[model samples]
Target: MTELVRMTGIEKRFPGVHALKQAQFDLKRGEVHALMGENGAGKSTLMKILSGIYRPDDGTVEIDGQPIELSGPKAAQAHGIGIIHQELSLMNDLTVGQNILIGKEPRRSFGRLDERELNRQAGELLGSMHMKLDPKTIVAELTIARQQMIEIAKALSNRSRILIMDEPTAALTDAEVSELFAIIGRLKSEGVGIIYISHKMDELKRIADRVTVMRDGEYVVTVEAADTPVSTIISMMVGRALKEETVTIPDLDTAETALSVRGLNRGRVIRDVSFEVRHGEILGFAGLMGAGRTEVARAIFGADPKDSGEVFVHGKPVSIGTPKDAVRAGIGYLSEDRKHFGLALGMDVRANIAMASLGQFTDMAGRLDEKAMQATANDYIERLAIRTPDDRQEVQLLSGGNQQKVVIAKWLLRDCDILIFDEPTRGIDVGAKGEIYRLLAALAADGKAIIVISSELPEILRVSHRIAVMCEGRLTGILPGGAGTTQEEIMHLATLRDAMTEEHA
Candidate 1:
């Protein structure tokens, strides 16, 4: 293999942070190199330099043995480098076609945009990628997975040779991941090198050819993917060997039911979904994207209107017509989109933590008791082990795991006994994910019924006492967690739709 992209002695620094310290990376032609690191470890910084999003303070970037300067993203694209960010960057107000061909739109003879040609080109590009989507469809109407696909399509449309993918599988389903891996294979065969950044060890083993570990803004080691153990890679990234945890199977036979949903129906997403979660039990919801797992959580949390359903909490039927009603009924929902739906990112951590339980901290005259609120925030910050400079620090400045902990703190302060964590560890690193799992285990053992909805099968098996599989909009099957359960079985149930009595299932 030939080295296609190389950065040596790379160093970058921000105002108060040394983002990269002599970080080095090399991508060989047709090879998928995985970058492993904890948050703030300079992986993104290095890639941003490579993608022309940031200029290196000092270093050398070489392309095919020739030194080059990346002035901006367009220059990087012109130089055969493209990056698909972890966050979706498409415009929701535009059509799919417009979003895809934003800066590269086709023009008519009269110097106007060619709408038909734009849609036709976008449709052709999607078809080439084996995506089934209408170019005329509104971007906002598409699901997150579809939007991620559009992001990928936009990157590929640039004919980039050196592609950098940042957590591309974070929102994709197993089937979609397979499709993406296939696309990577095809691209690699065409001599395209990929810099794959992800927290999923299994994905690294499956698709990557080499693994590079970074710790605290410096490159630690790079090794062959197959020769390196996942544990070893994790150790290199964290500078310590982290112990792998196993969930303790608690006996729930004598426990009382904490939450029960019967005949849950909402439009076409959720139908006839019935399940029960007992006190001190962690029920895992496992399913493919758009399988209605999140939808069921939303309906039960009263974030969305359910056409017909009966919800029981602590053996008492509850009418949860809104989030306020749900919160009053001891239910707390930690939405997956924490920044927008869960926390006010602009507010301080203490303020956000107190948002959910403000009624308890307010005086009779509608005055906020600052001392009481601050005490509560401090208590939870200590209890949940949230890493923050201070409670006064803004939530937006905290890491993903810390931000999530603040949301958990909000619910705990409000005395919510039934907790729903939807995609709780979506974007966090492995170490942070371990901490969260421990927190949930403690919460469940303390007699709080936990409903964990996760896209990762391993995550579903990790913390749940029993896994409930959702396909399309219904509960297809339930399996006990631990040794007996396998990914194959969960995947089978995930695709087991009522209409799929045939080959699809």
Candidate 2:
């Protein structure tokens, strides 16, 4: 009901990019105010300024109608501000209690860690949120969802009155999201002002009181959550409307099987996962995160070592122990994390495109044919409609969707017959999502065996010819993709097996 935090005329600039321009944001006490924008829209930049991660070139910050200067994160923390970053900042080797209550450990007289007392404090903090994680459990051994919970616990330990959550539900399951929402509601009741940033529209309607949309580093509009339509919000955030429609899948019933995996196993992530993908089929692997979908693809593409598995390409068994073998077998893998695994961020688009199949563009003298490589990259760039100032630009400078196109271009240029796309549309805008979907459909139509791994149930239903769901380390069931399939049905199979069921199986 009262103003808890406000930033007026906030401006931040990087080397050549004006990241934020006079952005205005205000959060009321006990309210969840959502910050909406596409990637590079300055949502994170603006919030970082507020959290003292960056010093704004120009701005005025006010808390409780009083102007305040935030010199650093410590200052922000002193002012009751806490931020849960998009990426988990936990030390993998540390225990949950140690990470959550870092630097604030209760010491007993001497310099001892006071292990029992530390866990007791941590347990109380988790208990407040109804979390059952043991404080002494190693963070490395925890699931992504559990790690996220620990992040939240760490934030709450600060006794923060203003919480900034960036894409909090990015890795959470439906059930876990619900649990988080419950905690958020409790925080709201306790008069905690929350700044929530997410691309998920449905969540805003459920949790947010007000919505603020930004586009092109400028604040667009602010509207009450109850009154604004999701479509209107999306249009404002992306500067355009997106028609959500299913991609057109070509007829591939008679296409020959392109890839066949038999008894695939990678530790406990994947177990006996066997499937066949036809040349013109888009086989979708649908499940919750850590359901072995990505693992299966990585193992097949030889990104990860297979404990035991056999891969067959076009009816012939292929020995794939490394990525080189997979590439020779005409297989290409598009990693889920584009920034880390998919592309070389430091290299130009043409170089990255030619990376996978450099031999094709190399002369007998072992020197690269720059002109030929540029021509090839340019052709695919134009064909895929990749938006870039020039093909010479670095792939990292491109937008999320455009970077994904570059990754796809690299594989396609390598003449890979079987392609695996993992979370291809993640961090991509809605309009670009459609473009990527169309690209995938066209690739399938051209007889490229396609395996798509996605967490979005709607994506799986729309683009897949056949759907496979994994639970724990096992492939539980497969469904015919169409109108008959539902998200609930997929989730049922995704979490079907527990320890007891695994023993029985």
Top TM-score: which candidate number? 1
Q: What TM-score fits each model?
A: 0.91, 0.89
lDDT of 2 by residue, 247-314 (tens): 56566667798999888888889887777899988888887777888788888878879899889999
Question: Each candidate: how many clashes?
Answer: 0, 0
> How many pairs of residues collide in model 1?
0
Return the lDDT, model 1, position 373: 82
Q: What residue pairs clash in candidate 1, if any at all? A: none
- Candidate 2, residue 345: lDDT: 90
Q: Write the per-residue lDDT of candidate 1 for residues 309-377, one digit (tens) a residue.
A: 899999899999999999999999998878778999889988999998788888899999988888888
